[model samples]
Target chain A: MKDVSEMYIPTYDDVLEAHERIAPYIHRTPVLTSSYFNELTGAELFFKCENFQKAGAFKVRGASNAVFGLSEEDAAKGVCTHSSGNHALSLSYAAGRRGIPCNVVMPRTAPEAKKAAVRGYGGIITECEPSTTSREEVFAEVQAKTGGDFVHPYNDPRVIAGQGTCSREFMEQTGGVDMMVAPIGGGGMISGTCLTLSNIAPEVQIIASEPEQADDAYRSFKAGHIIADDAPETIADGLKVPLKERTWHFVSNYVSDILTASEQEIIDAMKLTWQRMKIVMEPSCAVPLATILKNKEKFAGKRVGVIVTGGNVDLDKLPWMLN
Target chain B: MKDVSEMYIPTYDDVLEAHERIAPYIHRTPVLTSSYFNELTGAELFFKCENFQKAGAFKVRGASNAVFGLSEEDAAKGVCTHSSGNHALSLSYAAGRRGIPCNVVMPRTAPEAKKAAVRGYGGIITECEPSTTSREEVFAEVQAKTGGDFVHPYNDPRVIAGQGTCSREFMEQTGGVDMMVAPIGGGGMISGTCLTLSNIAPEVQIIASEPEQADDAYRSFKAGHIIADDAPETIADGLKVPLKERTWHFVSNYVSDILTASEQEIIDAMKLTWQRMKIVMEPSCAVPLATILKNKEKFAGKRVGVIVTGGNVDLDKLPWMLN
Candidate 1:
């Protein structure tokens, strides 16, 4: 991601305020530890369970922050975004908390379960063709008619600051960790981790984990520039997006490394977590542990804080159950 | 459960000692709440997530207490049990924690996942024909050969005392609840709850939940005597066991009601829990919530503590996925 603005980079104070602003609406999700994972990776893992976050992901923090951070005049129009995943439902949840309308522009081909989730949270969905251009075009019309605030899932400073609170709370909860690892898609969570850790605990290493199939972030980190993919497929559906300007600034400056894991490793680790840790987490959230296990020499004997990103899995459509 | 002996009924002091004994071996799992389920059932539910406990079940408390409570001379002989479920693995885990030899007699028809779990925790397994007489015959031979002490899954005084600690912790964590609910198999957990609550929080209602297909505990509660079923079938395999002497004592004395849920209702509630609470739990754990949902008028507008029993589930064989 490139720097979206020359002067509006979110500072530590913004993150502090975002924490205070969204405290009422968001959950201070618990941090869980697994001795089984710790022994497997040779790392003392403190899993920040964002899967237990409201709306079933950490995206709620950013969505709530963006919704609650709005000015009285802008807030009246409501909030709108284009997402087919947790972001859509999170934005709707935040809007519901604020008693404001939420408009979601999603592909018509999106799963009915996801569509129902969006509507379940009081979101008004306007379907678009399953293409980026069509989504943006449809979103523009919806935003124009509703005069709703556009809360980008990532890239936006408020969203970044809101996500930063996760790492902030993690740091305070665990006292401190030697390193922080989070899965990367659009780089929102990793960027937030970098932003918060760099300001408060600069010595803590920030490592971003991504699937080898969707290794755009790994490529971008190595190339010293942004590399956007049209549509890379992986079991880790949450990490299909590319890094944008605002997120890239943090990735380039603060991220220690961007590691990629094989598809098999992610699935194996995800299954192990569900069995051993007794927690339900998505495949994307399993990437960090997957990468950590693959490179045990790098993480061994260290206190590693791994972000469990979400738990919104289609139970009937489990990857292992698929042909 | 009838008193196993004329004078050896476990007292509250025994529960306190068990709590202290197992504290080092087991996890004090977090108490979780789902506002979603609360709204759906019109009851404030606080889930004591024993599913997240060591060995993925609350049985570890009793197993650990028994393991650690043994005299050094008696400990040298080791411990033994006959179980095909969480108790088998949990006893193995507890024995491993205490560096003692553990032997298990399991039906050959038990899931391979469970057998592997027992082995993972250092349990030596002896397979038996899948019947009560066969299991006892095989277990007796194994115990005689090994000179290992028999640790009944739920009937032993130490095991009941250890399970009582859960309610003790729940009372401390949530301050207190109007009613307490847990699934009944041989009545171990329910007996433990009855033991603790009757002594300390006698005002609290103790409700036992069971699968209607294997409603031995339900029948016993109404009949005022233990009802032993030769063979009953249910997806909640853990609840198929008949109430034993020790567990029957507590169930008969303190339980207000023994509610049963149909097989379909249990499956639905289990799926709802996995989806809404974002946690992985076995079918047996879902019985409490299923009964709660069925008896909404009885639980409505009241604070209820529901014990989430275990998460040792075969992910590939989820009930909904089965034909």
Candidate 2:
């Protein structure tokens, strides 16, 4: 495999390779539909349910691809990443599948449940300050000490290629759709979606949904360049990160539009889904549906594919129950 | 079709007919598995997800069968039932599918979410007191006034036959299981499981799970006769009803044992499932898992089929949130 650090953009071919390589480690999650939402929006919505994926998120696809795609020499050093959320859990899961050591650098402030999950997957954790700079500095030291290959959460070509497999599966499962909507955080899921759909179903529009509280990606799309957010807050904790260079390539080139949803809209959509669709999805995953609901005229009567990115929410602290 | 009010016991042939009748109206829900639970309990568990079924519960299977099997004359008059739960929503959904009126006699104290769902499906609600005596009295009056076909939630032969279809699908989906566990209330799902498994796979042991607070079924199983509780209470609201004569016929004869879980145990299991399996299921549905976790020795290393009965929970009132 080419060096993931080289800034090499992944193609459809790389996605095909990722799909084949990660087949044994990840699940091809089910596609679900909701009649209530369909009637309310006048759009036929098909939800690609990655929440039910292994490790309770779609990041497993990228993590599995990164871990298993490693050459024997690289694999021996094991894999390491810096994440306090699903990526941390997912990378650990992937490493466990291969029976290799996985090191994670997490902020000390991360939720205990998430830390426990990382440890549950046999990941060795090195705690860092909650700041991005501190996390990066700590993660570098861990990688230097262990010689573990770095797996950037979304910026790596391998991860993007792996994420593309989801849209491939979505297209195959649903035949086709007029538009595809996904929530953008660091833009790994959206970039992967862009790569796959642009190569195969270029006619389909790709819409990136973002939380208005953390609208850096939205601002970047309009500004036509990569924009960085030092710190932003939202109920959609997963979507607080800024877009990087690799993701911005696809977002600027292939994504048809970027949409934003308010914090209340995200929470409302999340609760409504749990009540009506009877599925547990995170607030970040609800951004797509929230945007669609807010801009119904754009999606009404169209076949829309919604990527429900993950289902890793703290059960005791649901957003609706917090009031 | 045989008269539902005649206390007729349905057979495998009736189950087959019911399956065919409801095929067009109901969803053949997917069976889900969790490696975490498998490792914890040492049992190979297959969760038959009726929580994802049409109208968000397995009750839809019975409701669909009753609504579709009625003769043109009977169907024209519509159908009625008294339930403050999934059955009310299910019958309403089934009737809506058939373009027929459905009258639900629900307790006024039923959560507004459930009431709204019933109305959303075109069910006309006739409110009554929370007590069963008042429910029955009001239901009788409504039936007399509308001349609607009375569809008992669990006791009717047609309903049992319909519910039996779930096990048929479960067996087909999982090949077969060593033990099948389902939560017991009026024992509709358990009775149906008994009818199906006993006819086709009698070797598979049927276990009924009940809440400790609403332990009438557990007590009745030990006493070798029906035991009615005047007003039992539990977080598993769907399981407060005692076994009716029609349901007891199968429960007593076919079920190998009855299990019960305390309210706290049920809540813990429910929260664990949402966190780990990432599925939105109601407290009533958690009884099987609660009992399985409680009695690990009974199910260790065996292929166990779990019925996740429903997912129509109030988002604002999660049991764990009540301090």
Candidate 3:
């Protein structure tokens, strides 16, 4: 096994550079402190609301940093990616700002709203079957056809560095947090968070929250092995991806623990955010709150930070968990 | 009418002082810019999202300033008000912070969600019949019983001064927008907006948007007389109040126009905000957007600022709005 510390981990300087690169392109989403949520869970919770971030998710931070970091000639060549939702929107928005053409390979089963948002931001979409085989096959065909540079959603070092920028901002906004929890989906956000926290505030415990149904990261972290699954079923559609080689190394080394929450808990937290905070959060974004609610004893009376990943849920399809 | 130009209009300096007075007690709600809205309206639209403000409305800005500006002895005596919804929640939250009791006289027809929010913030509710006579009668009885100071929702000079803080923040963020529009209920928001714009950005046009069914402000502004109706029908529950004396003087002098939008237009804008901006806004908050959409020619290609007043709509009641 490769020594995890030797793996590609972003330094504080790298994150600072990424922040500077994306400063003009992306919004520094505010950290909203919820006294209502604190009273309910007995923890001082600072919700890093990336739901209000540009392109409606933290994905924009990484996508903007990567696209802007590219040379003018390379950017003119354009960018390509395969994503079911938020990543596609971010890449499309980032590319739109630079007037670069973006092609996204999205699963046919992806929500219409997600597809509309991607196209709305000027990304050309090609529908593929809902499997790894189909995504890679379709992406390769599109890459060959368009000659666009492929941007991996999570595995790329640049993308990880970009994701670290969110944590850097989080720490700056909130002087120093004792613990930070973020939802693990494709391991992109968590990997960046881990890398950034490891350098800036090594004492701050970094915890990963995953949907129990899609517990590949939790299982992999526990067993100290790369766990790849053909398919996973969870309402957190973003977390369906198993950890890739680059992300797996960072998670194993820097993440203190990976906690799992039930699908019902995710839905409940989503409803709670909507009702109490009046913020429309998607199910995947609610995983951190779900983990905190389920394991209150672990976080009681502590200044804990939770990343609310996104707010792209369809109004017509709110989860039945509230009822 | 007593030389409107010489009327007591709050200065930018006064707004600055109010901001400082209420800074600790009030939230600095984020200013959300919508590219989608800009594309749709052909205007660079900045939504001063008071929906995300504390107590879910801009009322908290005024309520906090009013309550906190009181002497320590006066604060200890508590505060009372008669409001259909938002002001009640704002007063409750502000009073709760001071550890003082609040008595809210509300119509029995008030929404359950609002009532629950008021109670959640530790407010005492006094239910009254849904009429001006009943509301006044009940409020007088409550004031006589509790000896609490009456923090008039929109009529009080302190309340109007409090609302001015929003425009002060807006001017600082956007730096001299071409036009500013806010919904007109009893004109607390617009009155404050006009005062702030008059002092800071004197060249900016101040427009007031009102629901057609509740166009008392429009009528009154045109005829140069107070228009008081026994009852008005509108889904914009927030705009039911007739113009008060202090607000009337400001609106009469500083407001460029009072535009009216149909209930359907307001509902459409509400839906569009939810679908496109991913922000929850009530009918009253949507009035400005609705007016802009309905009269596109007037606002087209201009830098427009809209105050999204609040987001306290009941989720269950939304499906019925489609009808």
Per-prediction DockQ comes to: 0.84, 0.86, 0.35
Query: What is the C-alpha lDDT profile of model 2 across A245-277, one tens digit per residue?
Result: 999999999999999999999999999999888
TM-score of chain A of 2: 0.97
Tens-digit lDDT track of model 1 for B39-149: 999999999999999998999999888888888997989999988578899999999987999999988877677789999999999999876678889998998899987
For candidate 2, report its TM-score.
0.97
Error of 2 at B7 (Å): 2.3
TM-score of every candidate's chain A: 0.95, 0.97, 0.95
Q: What would the per-residue lDDT of candidate 2 be over residues B1-323, giving only the tens digit for each residue?
A: 67666778999999999999999988899999998999999999999999999989999999998999999998999999998588999999999999999999998877678899999999999999876788899999999999998999999888999999999999999999999999999999999999999999999999999999999999999999999886677889888777899999999999999999999999999999998988999999999999999999999999999999999898888999898
Per-model TM-score, in order, reads 0.97, 0.97, 0.89
Docking quality level of the chain pair in candidate 2: high
> How many Å off is the CA of B92 in candidate 1?
0.9
What C-alpha lDDT does candidate 1 achieve relative to the native structure?
Answer: 0.89
